[model samples]
Target: MDLLGGAALALGTVVVVVVGGGIVALVVVARRVRSGAIPRFGGTGIHELTRRAGTLLVRLDDRLRDADSELGYAIAQFGADAAKPWADALSGARAKVAEAYRLRHALDDAEPDSDRRQREWTLQIIALCEQAERQLDEQDDAFTRLRGREVSAEGTLRELRSRIEDARARAAASRELLSDAAARFAPAALAAVADHPAQADRLLDDAAVRADAAAAGIAPSGVSSVSGILAEAEQIVHRAGDLLESVERTVRDLEAASAALATRRRELAEDATQARAEVESAPDPDSGAAILDALRELEAITPLSPADPVRELDRLDEAASRLDLALAGSRNQKQRFAHALAAYEGTLVSARSQIAVVRDLVAGGRAGVSARTRLAEAERQLAIAEAETDPVEKLDAVRRAVTHARDADALARYDLGG
Candidate 1:
């Protein structure tokens, strides 16, 4: 009897364990449903719900299409002699029906992945179908009111249909114009605005996509939305044309500036050569040593190159200004060097103030890496200037320091817009 009792107790324990495991599994499934990882369709399975939704949408679309066709037939039989009020009512109803059908088809094709989204879409399609039915009922009422009147409802609908056809035609023409602009001018704009060709192409491509959407919205039956879309297409086409023209103008301006820069470069080279000769032939070689050093500094700067012509031109201009100062020292000798040194001392003071301001800007995150680098270089140059024994070399170093400090300040405040 004791052995029998032990077996019964072990069997009860196993049953309890199995029940606990089942409960845990059920809790996990409940959490998944709540989190939307698994669909909560009440008692209905996901596949069954989706099939029902699709069937409902298909039936709604077919009914809406049939209503639209009946209206179209009525309009064709009536001709332009229909009363204006009745025809307007009929056309509005027809448009609503067409929109409903379009919406239904779009939803059907969407094939929503989530159960929540699928349910939402299904509800929306049902609402649209109901709205379309109301519109058809209103159209019927309008026809009944106008029955036996001198103006037939059919005549007015025919006139309305013709107007819609004209609007569609206009929309088609606008679409064609946009397409032509994309084909003809987009590539040229890309080539002309080499610096920002991607931006140009993106704008054109976006406009093209909009145009295609507008074209698709243009139905055989009139839709008020088509009018707005056509207007948008026209505007997009005009914008593209303007963009191409602007790009062309910019290209021309750059070419002209390049030619002018070439001429200026040649002039600068000649002046530099003449200045070097004057310094070398000076009677007192010791007095002209600073001027000779300045010349060497100028020579150390890289020459103008095609890769960065604008920046190279700026460098050339700075060099030319320094060379002019050196040329003056070569002619006046010691007295001139003294005067230049005094001037450079003032410049050094100004530069130090500018560098301090730039440092603050850098700390505030308003300045860039280039600004910090230039500030460091300016400080180094200032130290070299102070340590120099010769007045001429001191003046040259001070001037270079001032230039670098001013450049750092400018860079700190440079506008990215340009």
Candidate 2:
């Protein structure tokens, strides 16, 4: 009897320990579910649950980041380290329940009457959400997992397929650009290879890799190029899709950047407005004249077009998306923003060149050469800038051209002949 009782007790102890562990795991997962944390198909329960310190949660968070912009969204997508559908449904339901709770709680503060009905309605939503949450539990062992990178992850994978098609157009464009660039350099490349076979071979491979990566990293909506270039570009494109880490990072940075831009813009606009108001209120012609003369001198020197300032502001607006995404998702946007700024700097350089041409022509008595001529020159420069494949090199060329134009015009106006 002593032996029998001892064996029974041991059996009971084992059962209790097993059951207790299962319960604890279930409870933690349940809390995660309630907090809008879905067990990512491949992500550890706690690992995927916490918000990434910087860019880890980009995949989950960037749902509505750029819902209304030009770079908006690619399309329906997927990923590797993604959870199953039921989990997503649960997460969505959890979000709705959270919203419902807030609405219901607010009901208690209401004056009365219909507020009760409102609270009751919210309760219904909570019930519905709970039901959906239960479905997540039911499907637990039935789901599959994938690698966690954006390309292979579940959610990102679906997204990848969708964006892949969209990327088709961009890929095509890149291919064309690469082809032209390759063709242009082919003679030089081949000749070098002929002269220094080993060196040429190495340079060609390096060139191919660099060009392809660049195209991939900055895959525009449409482009066309060669097969060799395409391969590199594809690899580069994948870089942006690296472990949804980039997405999360970009989203976070975009948030802060967007806020800063908004604050700065508001401050600048208000200051400018107030100063203008003061100037108008004074009603002094000489003061006005002084200001206008100052304005004229500045205009003659820089010709700050009404359109240019607006373009910069518009760029900020467009960039605000990157910001909203950072706030909502994840990304390393400073680098991207920096790249964009550099691209624009090149554009501004070209515009300054045209302004210089205008000044020079007027000064040198060549202003009568027809507006068509001036427009033609400006248009040609724009075409060249657009057609050039290497962003850095093309930008450099524009900067150089602009500098030359500016200097020549300045000389013509103040020193050369005038």
Best by TM-score: 1
lDDT of each: 0.52, 0.38
Q: lDDT of model 2 at residue 236?
A: 39
TM-score of each: 0.30, 0.19
Question: Cα lDDT of model 1 overall?
Answer: 0.52
lDDT of 1 by residue, 132-166 (tens): 55665676775555333213323333443443444
- State in Å the error of residue 10, model 1: 79
What is the Å distance of residue 42 in model 2 from its true position?
42
lDDT of 2 at 417: 41
